[model samples]
Target: MTEANSTPSVSLKLLVLVAILVVFAVVIVLLIFFLCLRGSRSWKRRKLAVKHSSGSIPLVSKEIMVVKTSDLTPATTSEIGDVEGDPKKEADVKVDIGAVTAGKSEVSGGGAHRSEVSVEDPNIGWGRWYSMSEVELATRGFAEGNVIGEGGYGVVYRGILQDGSVVAVKNLLNNKGQAEKEFKVEVEAIGKVRHKNLVRLVGYCAEGARRMLVYEYVDNGNLEQWLHGDVGPVSPLTWDIRMRIATGTAKGLAYLHEGLEPKVVHRDIKSSNILLDKNWNAKVSDFGLAKLLGSEKTHVTTRVMGTFGYVAPEYASSGMLNERSDVYSFGVLLMEIITGRSPIDYSRPPGEMNLVDWFKAMVASRRSEELVDPLIEIPPSPRSLKRVLLICLRCIDLDVVKRPKMGQIVHMLETDDFPFRSELRTVREKDPVSSHADVSIKVPYPPPKHAETVEKSRWR
Candidate 1:
């Protein structure tokens, strides 16, 4: 009986030792897990601090963020590389596109869901990435029937989205060396600007050697087509419609020149780049050649890229571009609108081939009436028309400093009391071939009762 009791005691001691070992093992595992958890928390805190550091990144809306290629999934990275060419090069290209700060809330089944869409980089705002398949489907596989326009930049197609929204898709050519750079420049330039008179960039698709830009579709065609298209002589654009186009276009340029933090100079401001909406509201388009002027800088020196006849003399000669350069182009457009003639017409007589030269000759000879378009059914008030002509002359002046600012031009167009009227009249009278002996030309129309109304109705 004593031996049996001793055996039970030994067995109890063994059981106690085994239980102790198991407890020790469990404690070690818990300690390791806790240490790992603490390390992970510290790492995450460091990352957050870096991301939120001041001045390192520009502040974007909470919902929108810049995306970096390195942060993208492997599949996305490969796709982007294919569309944009060298992935490293594309990443190096800095585009400051805007992103939405908040995502749309959706209800699925019986639950409310909020989806988080984020970009990889936070310095530049977000640019929506469109898959190739989506683009193709929207464009009907880029069918020939969908083609709207084509030029050196690329072919533009009318695309209908799944949401039934219409968009203009520009498929850039692949072989041009500057295509990628132009794409980035256009995306960044138009992305930052929001104006009723400026075309809006909807999204972009870059997939393996294919680069396409999506833009909000304007119902009516571009100004070039209306002005010079094969449409017969009985064009629908009346004088009032033409004036509206000019004023709207001027407002757009003014905004680009003065409204933004850094002024944008649209290097190409020809009729071809001005698109019209259903209401004949004009919006500036194709910012591929646009240049931004910083607050401290007056001009940027770059290679001149614009149409032959519409290019500013100063810009074309010296390769120096500024707001004044665009003013010159607008002056040409103004002349085109008044006379219903292209800036250059090879079919015209040699002396009249260039519209600017013809205009100067006509103005010098006091035959300004000859410049009016015969197609105009209801001409503007004589005084108003004279003011517009004088403004155009001032804008296209040989001396860049003499050109009026876009804002000033807008004011002059709305009001008959142009600040430079006396100076322009004096210059006209001093011409050796002046037709009239008297220098006094009275203002035909009385000034508007409410001068401020001009500003409010037109510019504001």
Candidate 2:
């Protein structure tokens, strides 16, 4: 009887120990479940907040291809090197970049999923700033081989984000005075302005001592290269393509002048600043010298800063920066597109050094055949030629008041005598140039009551 009692007591002890173990295990499991739920909630909240503030290019069922010039390309989402910066600018990304579109591109990153989007400053377009470490990785340690180009502002390197987003990082060297102000102003202004004819700013990284802007990588580069270079044309931008670019650029400028709340002036307008997309749609970039208009209805006073050759004659001679200043620069660009000549070539005789004067003199002298590009001796049509020349003249008007508003210029470009024929090619043989149609476009409203009555009577 004693042995049986002892055995029951030992069994009871074992049961108690087992119960305690089970309770401890249950507590641990519950803790883990709650922690996971909390972490997941935090992640979801961040994503939702970021998405609402910053809209991204929603994924569509479209295949992205890298427009390869040569087959060599970068690996997908390759690890970029580390960046030393304030904790905030550092990033650990895993994004899929889309295919390469630029002509000079050999490689591109797979497009990124929505998670790759930046949570800060959702307003920044195609450009974002990468920490020194991240950029180093994108450029493979800022290797000399990766440096694509440079300018007065800074150097540009081709980089691939972990998410496979291909971007061009403009590493600015000097951010002092106007240069620094321009950097910030451009970021603030262009970030808010979204239009097809404007280049997209992906994101930007402003790390310690390092400032950079990110832009959608343009493969073909600037227009000056393909149009005037000795290299046999790699891409033949058709006449229609040219017209579309002209129209698009004009629209962008018009947006700057009249579209804004108080209006802005693009002090500089030149061919080099015009960037083209895959479709040859021209985008106006580089508003480093742009001036914003205040409530003052008339032109404001300021120092002049623009490309010498493309600056408005009046603004260049006397710092009179205004909307008309931009109009004048547009004229110079228009002439270049028509004649493919440098704005001021000292090599030309004294009279010919000035492109506007040379071309206008030729046109007025009825030497129309001489102004046509040699490559297109027999251009597709004469109407196209005359219209271009006339528009160029109106743009270069000596008086600011005489210049056609961008809206009016766009109208003439859209006029019905489009896609000209061979016969319409006849040069302006009539003594009076029919360009008055373009000038008359500036009239804001219908003729006065008396004038309207006179017209009705004449019709009768």
Candidate 3:
């Protein structure tokens, strides 16, 4: 009887243990279900926040927003005007800064947004975007007669907008390597910056494989045509006009070098890249080849790409580019302007084939007057001419360190007083073995005694 009672007790203990385990499992399942439900609710709330924060403007993906396409449609303009007039419409259109800021912070890991959308300006809505059909209609289907200019990059056509506004449209060549990057660079470089000297980017069109840039129409032709075209010799540029062009070009370059936040180096500073307005004001154009320099970085290393005649020697050889390289090219341009000669001409005598070399030889021999263009009827003041020549020599110094900065060049050009003294020193060419090779020279410039006086007097 006692054995039977002990067996019942063991069975009772086993039953109680099983019941406790079942209750624990049910509790765990309920807890898991509650957690999942909470997570779902939180996700829905965040989704609603994003939805409510974005107004009429579609929430473009990060990639599209970064590109900043300046395409203004007729409908978009009308919508913008309506928003401006109606307070409620304006409020609806306005972005919820708090939500956007929070979302961006989460998406970017608390880092700044790389592709932040700029607040739309009421005066100028976002840039106008043109459809491919509209561009074709404006350019007459890219007809041959409509083409105004052509370069390695692509062809430029004169287009008339519906409002009778004239624009120059650049159609980038489809097959060229890095054409898209070049397009983006041009748009980014010139889109934000506005100056009388820099070319204005009105709008752009990127439809399918077609990439085009629209710019304000400059009435007068380029400096290259005026300086070297068939009409150059017959109707020579006057002394005053030449000076004005030089001064204006210098100011533009100085602005590019110093005025912008991150300075820009115009890799190709040649006569062909400089355009003239109706008033004959020089405006720098063709920023497709421009390079940006950060505040800390002094130079960039890349494959040298520029016109052969206008490229700086150091840059052409080693592919090291900086503002000084641009200065060297500008020196060559100044030489061309003075001599009315091409940078390189096969027709010229072998000794004078290269304008820079010939100019150097003349300056080394103290016969710079002979280098002046014969087409110039009324010669510039002798002192002024000599000063300009010296400035050019300093700009093209063999040692890059010796080259004057663009700002200094501008001051030297504008002031009557000479601020620096030039000393010419001859050095052998890179090839020490070749006696027949032309010897490279260095022109060092030391500040003159009267530099301070000139600066003070100009200010006074």
Candidate 4:
């Protein structure tokens, strides 16, 4: 009985040993599998780090390609070197770029070959970026002979680009503080504006401490030269030409005030700012003092900056600025155009020293014909003369609310209707009692009741 019991105990001990060995084997297998998975993960992380640190990483999905030429062409994903993609797709990229460059040269009339292509900066809006060296070459090193105009702001030089395109370059006075601000304002204001009556901004150069603006070359001179310059006694500008200029200027101002999203107040509008092209079309230039007002705002409160005689009463006195201020300046310009008199001429007699005062006095006395410029070869008729005088008076109205908008002024100037109708009570419609049939007699209105009408009015 003792031998049988010992045999059963040995069998039980063997079974327990077998169970412990199986558990140990399972634990070792699990540990080995976990270590292998951790090693693979670590290797992958190191590989990614190596790629980034070595500067071999791929670019973002969206790639930018800039074209230096006048035209812009969209580039394919494979064209950008750093971007990751199918290796086979990039084989023809170099050939495609070459073709584009060649095509640009041909299209631009074979100027200096500029093959270097890179991404464009967003800060330079709407205009090409010109290097200082390029500007210097075009202006012939800013030679004195190249200067077409000089003013407090800067000097304007006529230039011809490598492409044989004529351009006017304005070299701004580098006062450091003020010039920088003016450059920013001018570029932001007129950079993208394209109108027949507005000078076009071709490009700009802001290199080192210098600031310059390139504009389309207007062959004919400015209005100031034609109006005030020595033209051998008899002025070349006929009455009709003067009217055309006035109409064009009004249209340009209308676009600025009503057509643009953020209306621009020219701040300085005078005869000097109106440029004439080859066809005698008016182009409004020099926006150095332009200010922008949002649609939500009625006016901008800012420093009173404008020509002394052209500045409006409200603006010059209280600094309340709006589109009406520009209208006031335009009125002064119209008077200048009409009388050929400086806005403030000390040379005139005491009472006639101020053109605005003299103009109002003359009209009040019904001597409006005396206000015409003597230099004009053919004088304006009584009706046309009175209409323009009324329009001018409306623009320069002391009450800003009574002043006509630029659009209304343009319509009034273009149309022959007397005392152009407006919301202002000053411009009253004809009395209903007066027979409408009298309008059939297209004859111009007779002279003022007190004064005897002259066959041909001679300006004093």
Candidate 2: tens digits of C-alpha lDDT, residues 33-107: 999999999999998875443432222111223322233122211112221112433221111121211222232
Q: Give the TM-score of candidate 1.
A: 0.70
10 residues in a row with least lDDT, candidate 2: 451-460
- Using lDDT as the yardstick, the better of models 1 and 3 is 1
What candidate 1 gets wrong by more than 4 Å, as runs, is 1-127, 419-460
Q: Report the lDDT tens digits of candidate 3 across residue range 1-460.
A: 9999999999999999999999999999999999999999999999887654334332322211232225433111112111112332211112111111112211256332322233333223224556555677689878999898998878999999877899999998866434554565565456556788877877766544456788888888888888878774444576677777777888888888888756778788888888888777888888867776666768877556677677887777766778898898899999988888988788999878878778877766667678777778888877778878877776777678878788988887888866433222132233343111121223323221221111111010
Model 3 clash pairs?
Answer: 70-128, 71-128, 71-129, 72-128, 72-129
- Output the lDDT of residue 167, model 2: 75
lDDT of 1 by residue, 268-385 (tens): 8888888999999999998876776777878866666777777777666666778999998999999998888998799999878878778867776667777888767777776667
State TM-scores per candidate: 0.70, 0.63, 0.67, 0.68
Off by over 4 Å in 2: 1-129, 175-178, 233-235, 418-460
Candidate 2, residue 186: how far the Cα is off, in Å: 0.8
Per-residue lDDT of model 4, residues 289-361, tens digit only: 7877678878866666777677887776666778999998999999999999888788889988877778777
Ranking by lDDT: 4, 1, 3, 2
lDDT value for model 4: 0.70
Candidate 4 residue 191 C-alpha distance from true site, Å: 0.5
- What are the lDDT figures for the candidates, one per model? 0.69, 0.59, 0.66, 0.70
